[model samples]
Target: MEPLGQDEIRASFVNCTRGEAKGVTLPAPPSEIPWDRREFLGWRDPKAPARAYLVLPYGGEVIGLALRAAAPPKSRLRSNICGFCTTTHGLADITLFSARRAGKAGREGNTLGTYACGNLACSQYVRGELKPDVPQPYESLTVEERAGRLEEKLHKFVARVLESR
Candidate 1:
């Protein structure tokens, strides 16, 4: 994805600081996460960790990002499907990722999270669905091409958010 602009990043920090962060509704886990895993995942407690989150004022929607820090030591199996593409990453391909949480002032903190994709692209939660500048993936594109398309979409969404405010 295109790098978030300075202003956008700053705005994101404001949102995090203000506790305005938002997350998608998720089903309860079958078993409660263990304390060690909870700490590793940045969750203070398994019951209420802020997973499945996306930043807001970015095209008026939050995108799910499985941040790098929150990933498991090894990838694990997933029975759930991708919310974006609506296709399973397959039981084996599925992995968890942590979302980046901006901390107050100079502090950078990891807020615990577990997402299905090791990469944070939540296509189902895309904020640019009706926008003109963003591009959708096509049948013939290479991996790089698809990534570039999504990058453009993310940048455009950020710009739109800034414009609105």
Candidate 2:
């Protein structure tokens, strides 16, 4: 992923109002980000644990989505998998995050949700920089292959949010 400044991030949001986009926080400047190691920039709102955001390179431009976490699960299942990184995690480490659809659909309260790493650090997880709480099953695929799979899933999720219908 390329480096993205605050202005780009604010402008890239399609599922949020302009005012909400402006309020999204970046813990550090764009230059300070470890861009080479990331496939997308994702983080929760520092002030609002329930709010999160994701920005990634898509087609010719960057796309961003504002996400909200679903209510906490009642049962603590021992294992779960993140849709993006395909890593196994304890139920508590996974979250069901929903993003409002773009355009009129979003305004009408339409949304799509998927389970993912609660911290939104799939990029690091796939690269072995981060590890889930439970042991991950061995995969024959190489790191690059896993990363490609992550990128593909990310793109699909973004496309669903951007879909007009």
Scored by lDDT, the top model is 2
Q: For residues 35-141, what per-residue lDDT tens digits would candidate 1 score against the true structure?
A: 22110111122344423333323344433222333434443543544322323454443345443443341144434333343333333223322222223333565
Q: What is the TM-score of each candidate against the true structure?
A: 0.30, 0.97
Top model number, TM-score: 2
Candidate 2: Cα lDDT at 147: 90
Pairs with backbone N, CA or C atoms under 3 Å apart (clashes), candidate 2: none
Task: Return the TM-score for candidate 2, rounded to 2 decimals.
Answer: 0.97
Task: Mark the regions of model 1 whose C-alpha exceeds 4 Å error after superposition.
Answer: 1-4, 14-54, 58-68, 72-80, 83-86, 91-93, 99-110, 124-165
Residue-level error in angstroms, candidate 1, position 17: 8.5
lDDT of 2 by residue, 48-161 (tens): 999999999998899999999877698858778998989999998899999999999999999999999999999999999997779888899988999999999999999999
User: Local error of candidate 1 at 99, Å?
Assistant: 4.7
The Cα error of candidate 1 at residue 94, in Å, is 3.3
Instruction: Locate the minimum summed-lDDT window of 10 residues in model 2.
Output: 70-79
Q: Which stretches of candidate 2 lie over 4 Å from their true place?
A: none
